[model samples]
Target: MFKWASYFLCSFAVLASKGSWATLQDNNQTVCILKDAPNQCGSFCLSALDPMQTNLDAIERKQGVITSQLWALISRQDVQQKSLPSLDYELRRHTEMQEKHISHLLAVQSEMQALQKEMLHSILDVYKKLNAHQTLVQESLDKSITKEVFENRLEGVDKQLLTIGSTMAILMSRSVDQPHTVQNQSLQSPQASLQESLSEIGSEPPQFEQIGSRHFFIEHNLRLNWTMAAQRCRQIGGHLASFQNRLEFNAVTAKLLTGDVYYWIGMNDLGQEGQFVSVASGNPVAFFDWGYGEPDNLGGNHDCVDIAHAKMWDSKCADEERFICQSDNEV
Candidate 1:
């Protein structure tokens, strides 16, 4: 189509130069045909350009629509691009928080484990002490007698002495009136004969071991429950022994026992689960020698205390044991 327009314009320029049909002028920007004579060239050129003008206007309107759509697409892309940084920030923040929470949880778990391990060790230590003392206690009990039997034996001996002393006294009084020479004989008085007989028997009452102005005793030949032992001590004008210091505890404990055995002390928590008091003084114990993890109160029945190997342990109150009696009275 452009070739046809060019061919017609060139032909019109040639026809105007050669014939008296039209005048042609070049204004540098466009070609113009002067209608000096009534010429059809200019009119044909105008008619040709009119159709192309309409097509150009439609193309311009289409270009404007495309430009508007392109701008809208760019705007949407800009909005999406602007949101990425904030999304990344939120993701990073959540990750950091989660990491911190995990770290804290791990730390707490470690602490709990440490505490549990320590507790287990403490329990094991207590159990070892308990087992050792229990075995010794059992052995001691096997070699011991009940307090009642021991007392009965002593009472019988006393009765025998009383009768013998009376008989000797009567016989000596009669011999004194007769006046017979007794040579190389030492039986002169009833008290002397009684003492000689007692010496021959080689029996003496249980004596307390004393240290630092304190007297305490435990008969290895006696086995009694905690309550009975305490009652027996009271009957003997004393109470179950309580220690004021380590020196007194050690001194009395070392000498008062003939063999290894757990001995009941005055210390007990019968009135309260965790509070120990001495029955002798009825006050809180002034000293303590509790073994590791002691007073665990196994079975919740261990309100009494036993002293063994210089350490205190909780024991069942009803269990029989050897016990020391303490008396502050001067002998």
Candidate 2:
């Protein structure tokens, strides 16, 4: 029995050793798989992220283009707003200019109306003066016609007187030679006296006197004011005597027989103060023979000149005095 037990124990020890070696090999393979798991997971995540990043970049580019377009539209709106105020200011200035032009036209119309009124008044005044002048001219014409009729009648009377004187003288000459008896002697004396009277009546004195180619008439019966004396001279186709020099004055004075009688001359100061002029000649008097302190402008109204002998004196025009008349002789 002891020999059989020893062989069995040796076989059991060999089997147990082979089973332990197989378990050690399995444990080593499991440890290697655990170590390589982190590397595989990292590679899978990297590949998925690449496509998502590309899509985000495209969205950002579209948003930038939209923002630029909005800014351009706002800039155009701002420019239009600024131009509106400038247009309104120009319209207001034009309206004011039109108003000023209308006001100026109204003022010119008013001034023209005032000037027309003044012209109308001046025309009325001229018409009044013309009516007064016409009345004076009619009165002067009537007086001249009456004076001419009286002069014609006087000429006829002078002719009748001359014829009667000549017939009486012829009758007296025939009766003187036929007388001697008492009745005849008385008749003869009266006839002689009649003849002598007839002879004296036939020779009449001349009315006018000639001096230095000028004829002068002295009105001894009539005395008149300066104005009336000038009118009388004109009626006889002559003017008042105007002396040119000392010799002419002396010649005129010698004809006057009446002493201390003042006679009106042609000189007067009717035109201006202290400026004596001739009425007949219409010239300044060169020869002056004024008496001492004569032209003192008495009563501030002495405007006429009168002469006594060879001396001159100033007198009022209304005073009564005889005047000398002169005229050019018919050639």
Best-fitting candidate, scored by TM-score: 1
Candidate 1: residue 282 lDDT (0-100): 82
With a 3 Å backbone cut-off (N, CA, C), the pairs that clash in candidate 2 are none
Q: Tell me the deviation in Å of residue 123 in model 1.
A: 57
Report the C-alpha lDDT of model 2 over 64-182, residue by residue, as the tens digit: 77777778778777877787798788778777887787788778877888778787777777777777777777677576667677667677778777775665454544333222211
Residue-level lDDT tens digits of model 1 in 1-331 = 6557756775766576554422322323334445442254556665767788689889989999999999999999999899999999999999999999999999999999999999999999999999999999877865796767778889999999999778766654443332232221445565444333323321333466677778877756666788877765654557888888888877776764544578887889989889999889888888888888998999989999988777889999898888888885222
Candidates in order have lDDT scores of 0.73, 0.66
List residue ranges in candidate 2 displaced over 4 A.
Answer: 1-207, 328-331
Where model 1 places Cα greater than 4 Å from the true spot, the runs are 1-206, 256-260, 329-331
Give the 10-residue window scoring lowest on summed lDDT in candidate 1: 175-184
